[model samples]
Target: MKSLSLHFISIGGSVMHNLAIALQQQGHKVTGSDDEIYEPSRTRLQKQGLLPAEMGWNPANIHTGLDAVILGMHARKDNPELLKAQELGLAVYSYPEFIYEQSKHKQRVVIAGSHGKTTITSILLHVLNYHKRNFDYLVGAQIEGFDTMVKLTADAPLLIAEGDEYGASPLDTRPKFLFFQPHIALISGIAWDHVNIYPTYDSYVHQFELLADSLPKAGAIVFDDTDDMLDVIALKEREDVTRQPYDVHSYRISNGQTWLKTKSAGDVPVQIFGEHNMKNIAGALAVCDRLGITEEMFYEAIQSFKGAARRLELVTSNDQKTIYRDFAHAPSKVGATTAAVRQQFPNRKLIACVELHTFSSLNKNFLGQYRDKLDQADVAVVFYSPHTLEMKRMEPISPQEIITAFDRPDLQIFTDTASLQTFLESQSTAAPSVYLLMSSGTFGGLDVNRLGEQ
Candidate 1:
């Protein structure tokens, strides 16, 4: 691939901005536009010299010299720049579709599911990089050792991707994962999500079904055995397609540390713990094995992986108390993360605080999905902002409905972060306690690090 001129519409998104920076690194002239750009993305883009001179679409930005116009989901079909691109008869590609186009000649590994996509993808990338292998990748979250979330090169023969189930573009209703057509795919687990799009559980599950069916007959699909829905789909092979199902790796928790019980490598201790993560590690190893990474190498390489950012990320810690924040808004993720923290530190009193930030979690009908999800925590609180409801154009939910849905009569709920922060600071001061804050959105832009400090 030669250096080409590229234009991006609505490129200030986390993923879109990273891709823009990556393309510039590949020697492409990258330019992008967005209505508004926020922290991290804005700073990163400015650093890469890829930030748009002005925020907001401009038809003038689209021109004949551009090799391609990558569309971000934020851009509507009627975007002026997009319209100009079409009028100029220039190539237009959705983000994932463009990724597929760029890496079509390479061996692509797409890790997909409702959860664990980032962790699994990161695990694979860490192992591959540790072995000094050259591979491009597109992971959803920031990893400990990686500089950019997206990487593309002419020489790398393999590309690892975190395949999101979200829609590709505003004009493209199909899930983003549909475009990859990976030579290898991993379905972590299926939970009903994106109710606004899928509506029914079956409909949500069907997308993974389609992704599974899309693989080449000679390709492979690795999945976790713990999820019944995923097991049924993954275990059923498609003629030449290899189906591999993995369960939680043998392990035990002791003194707040998780050790993988390996046969030849001895006990391998890891930075991350929990049944979900164990399964994720197993699934990642399964894919690595298929790619010629030995079990010994997998264990050796994985020991150093702290975690992807914000996926149960440790904010601060000490013997008296520890704080962690996770991007867990869905019911399944909330339950899994809360359970992991409690199980890891059985002696500690767990204070699990999760904000009902995502549309699915905020929806009144979806509230019941969280019933008893946080029961394992010694103390738990659900926080959602009334202003958030207004911004999302959603109905205001009363505290009684939330309490009733959670099936915990005494469940604490908050509509404001100030009160939530005050309550948390007081409770978390107790010794031998863990404060696990979970959300897809910040608790009203609350600074979690400040809250975590003693």
Candidate 2:
């Protein structure tokens, strides 16, 4: 592969920055601009010598010499840099489009869904890496053994990617996964999310249907059969394409430890628990089977898989108590995680706290979706910031609306972090318990380490 000259717009984004670094490491000339770059992305770019000297877009950064300009979803369609690229007739591609351009020659496997995509992709990557297979990947989170989230190599014959249903970029309104054109795809499950983009539930589900229809002759789609919507999609008439369905893997929890039951292997002890994870394992196994990995190999490799970052991650643990932090803000994720934790520790009291941070979770119209989602927890708490609503230009929501939406009269709601913390401290006086802090954002900058202290 010859070195290519490429520029990125809105390079500070989580995946955008990682893609830029991946290309640079592949011996490509990479330049990018963004108005604001946060931690991790900022430091990572700096270490790679790719950080823009000045923040904000400058049309001067655009040049005819560039082979292609990759646009991130964070950038606006009217961005000056994007306009300049268009004026110059330079090829502009969304990050997803660019990823497809690079991996067009390789066999593609895309893991997609409203939830569990990251975990399923991470599992596939971990198993492939364990067998020393030569493959490239683009995962959403930072895994333990993988240094970067995106990797594109010239010689690798396989490319594993996590497909998101969100808009591809400001220039493209189509879902990101539509661009991958996977020879093999996995839809973990479908639950309505990103209400701001797909206002109607049917519209949100249509994206996955498009993916299923895009499969080529002899292509395969691995899906969760338990999901009614996914089951309907799989039933679509596609005689040429194979539909592989999977359910939750069998497992048993003993003395607070979850063990996976394998037919070949007597029992496989895994670090991660939860029925959702078991379902993730089943889906991953289905995909791996198509990739030529045996069930025995999968069990051996998966036993050591801790889990993707922020998915039921253990923050701190002791003989009597445990605290876990999860990136679960969506209704389906919140419910599944709450139930998983409660089931794992039936003898211990469970205190589950969730922060409403995403556009979907904060939307009044979408609030009803969360009804009974946290009912499994022994004590449930909800928190939201009014300042966030102001920033999003959304109408302020009252605590009563939330109470009515969740239909949990005993639910504790907090608008202030201090009060939430105080309430949390109050619960500590009770018997030995498990604490689950669920959110995609910080609980108003609450210190997890401090809260975890016994």
Candidate 3:
């Protein structure tokens, strides 16, 4: 419990920057270095007085007195500070490993899956904050209410984390969630992603099975029964761990508001919509229940929750049209996001555009997985940056390949953002249509909002 000095390698990353600020807030002397720092993170670090003067790693910053050096995945294996830490015999740990060590004495709740982790984590954090509960949290995306993505407190007895299945660090190929060893966990669902690392569906699923097996005997796992893969994994492993299965809770939409109806809890109006979010609500309620929050309190807290940033975020809206931006690139995410918008605005013509930005999404081998994902949209357009393919070291994919992969004869594929912009401008402005832009990356730095305006 004594004060400690911590140095973070590649501290400018979203999660790393927040963790550094969290440590500083907890009275720890935090210093960090990164090759580059971008907006939001750069501003955040400066606000907390944790921004390093220079960009590159400096071995002089690493000293024997440091209690631990937390390495971000962005840092390479041959990072100079990392080598210096090894030479000085200092303790080196991945970000997740360090988080687990800090929360070893607290109850851990991990939200896992290929998607929806951030939404569920944000919901839990909001509800906990509303109830005035002192708890630590680590979420991947920025939330409106929370100042930092990471929080470490001496008094908090609980730790909630958005458990991503991505590798922990360059040296550790194991999934980051493996280190948390949660007392309570939730799997939103299963969908194969990260094809660069997890080459096959079976191989990708094995990670979830391993995560399930890591739970302690008294631990509990809440999973979506809708996903057959998750169901099989839960039933096949860890009989000693309690299993809780949930599906999309009953909900009805009327006059632009979604209402939830639970047997135990009466109908409650919610700010967010979609069947996927309804399922997320059920999972979060189960976790909150484990923490002694009543069903009514959970509903009350969730009623005001807008949503996590970039998960169906509304960019702009006029009387005639609305534009939304979301970080939905995977097949499941694409389907869910498009379906949500269509369901919410049943009267509007939906124009959904998605960018194949990630390594997995851009891979020719994985393209077939996106078949019919954008079918819900009245007009579907898929975009991929040619430069992205080059950067990922992937073979150039043609528009014909993308259209064939989607299995939609009417699908339009564009490699140039400007051409897509022109196509969007040609759409009828008289009709009420929702413009949904889905991507993990900016579409070649194209201003989607500006395009929507035109």
Which portions of model 2 miss their true places by more than 4 Å? none
Q: Backbone clash tally for model 3?
A: 0
> Best by lDDT, which number?
2
Q: Estimate each model's TM-score.
A: 0.98, 0.98, 0.97
> What is the alpha-carbon lDDT for the whole of candidate 3?
0.90
Worst 10 residues of 2 by lDDT: 422-431
Which segments of model 1 are wrong by more than 4 Å? none
Model 3 lDDT per residue over 1-454, tens place: 5689999999998899999998888889999999999988999999988889988989999998899999999889999999999999999999899999888999999999998899999999999999999999999998889988999877789999999998999879799999998999899999999999999999999999988888898999999999999989888767589999988989999976799986766888987888899988988988899999998888888988988999888888887878889999999999999999999999899999999999899899999999989999999999898888887789999899999999889998888988888887777578888889999888777777676667
lDDT per residue for candidate 2 within 1-454, as digits (tens), equals: 6899999999999999999999999999999999999988999999999999999999999999999999999899899999999999999999889889988999999999989999999999999999999999999999989989999888999999999998899878899999999999999999999999999999999999999999999999999999999999988988699999999999999998999998899889998899999999999999999999999999999988989999999999886678999999999999999999999999888999999999999999999999999999889999999999999998899999998999899999999988888788778745688999999999998777877884
Which pairs clash (backbone N, Cα, C closer than 3 Å) in model 3?
none
Candidate no. 1 TM-score: 0.98
Lowest summed-lDDT stretch of 10 residues in model 3? 445-454
Each candidate's lDDT (Cα)?
0.90, 0.93, 0.90
Model 1: per-residue Cα lDDT over 1-454, one tens digit each: 8888999898998899999999998889999899999989999998888888887888999888999999999888899989899899999988899988888899999999998999999999999999999999999999977899999888899999999889999878799998988989999999999887888899999999999999997899998888899888987759899988899999998788899999979999999999989999999999999889999999999999999999989899888888898999999999999999989988888999889988888899888999999998988799999898999899999999999988888788988888988888778554688889999888887777777664
